[model samples]
Target: MSSIPIRIPTASIYEELASARTTPKTVTSIHEEDGSILDYTERSSDGPSMPPHGLSNQALPMDKLSRAQLIAEQYIKDNKLLKAHEELIRCVALSKIIHGDGHWRLAKAFADLAYSYLTVRGLPVQAKQHAESAKNILLRGVDMSKSVEEKREVLGTLVTIYYTLGMSHLLQNNGRESYVSLQKVQKLIADLEELQEKTSVLGKISDKDIALALGRSCVLQEKLSLAMNFFEQAVKMVISSEGDSSAVLIGIYREMARAEQMKGRHEQAIHYLLQAHSICQAVYKKLSEKAAHTGLLLAKAYAAAGRSEYNENTNKYFTESLSVYQIVLGADDPQTQNTRVEFSKWLIQIGKTQEAYKMLQEAVGSETEYSETVAEMLSIMGSIHLADGKIQKGYQLLKKCLEIQTAVYGSQHSKSKETQNLLTALQKSGASWE
Candidate 1:
């Protein structure tokens, strides 16, 4: 996760926001070593780092029968998503014909297919459709399983698929929604605990993995204290047996940073981010990117804590982050384009308004999926307009931003609040921003 830098509202604007707090509002993924969503939406080098699963069925029935399945899996492995998707649908149909509905094999095939779309094509709706299809099969299998072990095993797969759907939402930047999907995990955990009354071992495994996944989701929601407890419990499980999980350690550090930052301990936040960064650097380059991204935000947090004191340090970190995004993601990557806009906003604040404008123009030109980014460009330009005493132009630019957000997310979104607050500020100051 990255830091969202917010400008402080003027007193009158703050008053307006306070008054409007009760007014209506509305509208709404990751990989880590050994799990998904430990940290999501960061710079990456174009291929999934998650490992492929090996099919366990050695039955001749599935071998000759799963010929198309084999070819589909290979296509995904080779990064051919469209072809893989086409083949997988065919496989799903054949599996239904041969194994009938809701078979374990059928569910696994659907899960495999959904993952390919979610991770590779970045299509959340398509991913969600297949995941639900897969979940239905898993559910049916759970209901039919006669043995305790069979039921427990199927439950685990169900938990992972639900978690993957949550990832799809996360990748689309809908954190609130991702939380909703994860509610399914809580139900799954409850089911397993009930099962544990009859079988202890399966119960322990289910409890641990669910807690770990839940804690990570809490981290995304900025529930730091809860996340801290979750990670601590998770640590108890790992250090006791798993040993030296740097990825897990990285999460612990991140949660600490968030906790410290929320508590206004900027220096401490920076320290935790640095420690996290160091851990990733030493672990492997794949992990270092997480650290690097946090390091950039660490500096931002520090700047926010003491805006007047560390202006130069803030600029340094911003420049470093820009360099990292450029090198790691290329300028055209959606994440990089967003970062470019973020960097430009900081530039505008430091009196480099023209430079900020130029970068934003370039960003708007780039190919990317995040339209919310356009808000940043317009917001910065509006601020620049206000600074130049061109109140109407600034107000209009910001207004345009609000319009786009409203059209896309509707009137009650968290996004529209930014616009509302800005308009209120303008109304008070006798500026034309409204």
Candidate 2:
């Protein structure tokens, strides 16, 4: 049997998450390897911070399969996804030779290949094809199995394949299909638990993985509260496993913050955002693009948090995050421009119309293919102009913004309606365009 420890799903897990208070985990500055989240500190960590958890069928010898899987994983970490895909293909061929066709081991190889295609290579079509192949192979294995335990083991492998399929759908923006696939996986897990009578369903599937995937599906479904519960449970699982919290908890924290933000729980959102920032800072490269992305997320969260309670830290976070985005993403990048727009809007909110106007001017001058962002810049600038007593200038700018919005989103779009209403109000205020 493979020595890989797998997490099994159970009803108590969901029950606990549903009933527990949602609290951001306390983060410290030290790398306490005991699985606690650490402060955001740049480190010289070797290899990828998040490596794949080795999983395969128990029937295969662990050493050879593990070796190939590790090599493929390293390729993925190095961003050589094509190489990773090739390596997995080789592993799949080897598995077919050693474990024969229709074996669960071969099914696992196919599943891994599908994951590489879906996530690394961004080939959803190929990913779905391979996921189905894996599922069909695993189903055949389960049908031929004689013992209940054997059937359960094959089902566990299917759960992983189903997850890959869900990811494939998600990658293609088929959220409803993704949710359906995830639900099927959950049902399979439930069946396995029932058969085992609450015994650990820990085969090749982790409850944390399932929970996180389910959380993502719920997010697609707009069930923010349920999503947060699942994300919290996933975080708890990471801590309990003595795993590196930085690797696992960062994404969970970010998603949890998003859910809180959607629910208008700005304080809670900021808490989770801080936790995500802290974790990303702990292990992520200081000047890496990943750090910049995380900073951007924190910036938006800080801005939202400030909307409810304007604090110095909100400004501090925005300043630091904007600096990082500017340096790493460059002045012309859409995200950097977006960050500038956000900062300018914040400045306007705090009665800094002149500064906001200058900022928006700089942002609007930048060339971008994103007309939506351009429209946003123009609107903010118009608002700043209005606040600064330039009624005619604000009127022209608002009318221009409305035109851009209507062109991009059509006249009947909600965004266009908003701009139209704003322009009408400005006109009613005697702001005339000559």
Candidate 3:
């Protein structure tokens, strides 16, 4: 994540706003790693000529704010995210002291702090709170701006705030709200571009980011056409800016494949998956985990393409994926085991129950922990045994599946209940095992 610099142009409008309020609306506190709490409240009028609790040894508030901003930038560059987050908190407190609560500068500080929470700490809830606070302040301050520089600064801060807010909403699975927030960001960026008469706006938030986010939001809302359109726009933009061979295209192609599948355009979906698989083969090593994963996706896509004639392609990719996964990721890795389970299920679908059973036995032998994957494997194995009239073995496997499901998903979960019902039916049918 890039650091957004706080630039405050000299203006009497801001000066008047800064002096209109002495105290900020809320008190901010910082918790240190050593279990120390630093209160960043405003100093009383009659207090000594020193700073706040943790900043007593620092310079004046303005100078300290500048230093804190610089330190935060350095911390981010050094990948010290936790320390950078702390410094951003200090910047918020110092901005309140220097620019008051209602000034655009303070809003910019909040926007930066909000972005840090989202990008650096992956805390979307905190990001949304600070982004909303910034928006509130900016809404009140935007009308007072007169100069071009001030307008540019305000618009830049707004872009960051809306982008952060949109991503926060998306993370929380509020698709409609996320689309609304991202639309605001897109409009703000367009306005900024028009104001400058330039192709590039002055922020880290790009058109591609907006397009991809809008696409994801649309996908969540089941707006498949709009989602595909946005994804296509993003694809064109990325290809125009970065070359065709850029690694970013791999994910976009996979997303496009998913959208096509959702729309029941199986051939189109296969085309996109082929593109993604090709990219994976070229960008990563031939036998890399990424290549293996892409092969797995391609195999599943072929199997789901509603054409039994594509069984050859499906089997080829499945074997390639399994081989690479067993070599690169260990045979006991969750992903490898899951891939085995998926392939075994496909085998059973093609009427190769004995082959599927052997694969399931290998997976079960290596599984050391009780997980959803293990439970699924056991269930399938039990069903295979029951179909072969091995009642005693089937009963034992299903009983273990029931125990695992209850332990992992609780006894009241649908999976556990289903397994319980199956066991009951088996007993009621007079199937005896000793």
lDDT of 1 by residue, 10-38 (tens): 23432332232232121002122234221
Candidate 1: minimum summed lDDT over ten consecutive residues — where?
Answer: 23-32
Consecutive 10-residue window with the lowest summed lDDT within model 2: 1-10
lDDT of 3 by residue, 387-417 (tens): 9888889888999999999999999999999
> Poorest 10 consecutive residues of model 3 by lDDT?
2-11
Count backbone clashes in candidate 1: 3
Error of 3 at 67 (Å): 1.1
Clashes in model 2: which pairs? 41-281
lDDT of 2 by residue, 1-434 (tens): 12221122123432332222221221112222333322211111342221122422122323435666788878878978665665676566556656766688778788877776666666777778888988888666345358776666667667767877887787676767888898888888888877873245453357787788778878877888888888988998998885655468888888888788888898898788777777777778656566666776776776776564654666676677667777887877777777787778777777777887887787677553438888888888887777667788887888888888888899999988987997778668764543
- Estimate TM-scores for all models: 0.53, 0.62, 0.85
lDDT of every predicted structure (CA atoms):
0.62, 0.69, 0.81
lDDT-sorted candidate list, best first: 3, 2, 1
Task: Tally clashing residue pairs in candidate 3.
Answer: 0
Candidate 3 ranges with C-alpha deviation above 4 Å? 1-29, 32-58, 197-203, 366-368, 432-434
Cα lDDT of candidate 1 equals 0.62
TM-score, structure 1 vs. true = 0.53
**Which candidate, 1 or 3, has the higher lDDT?**
3
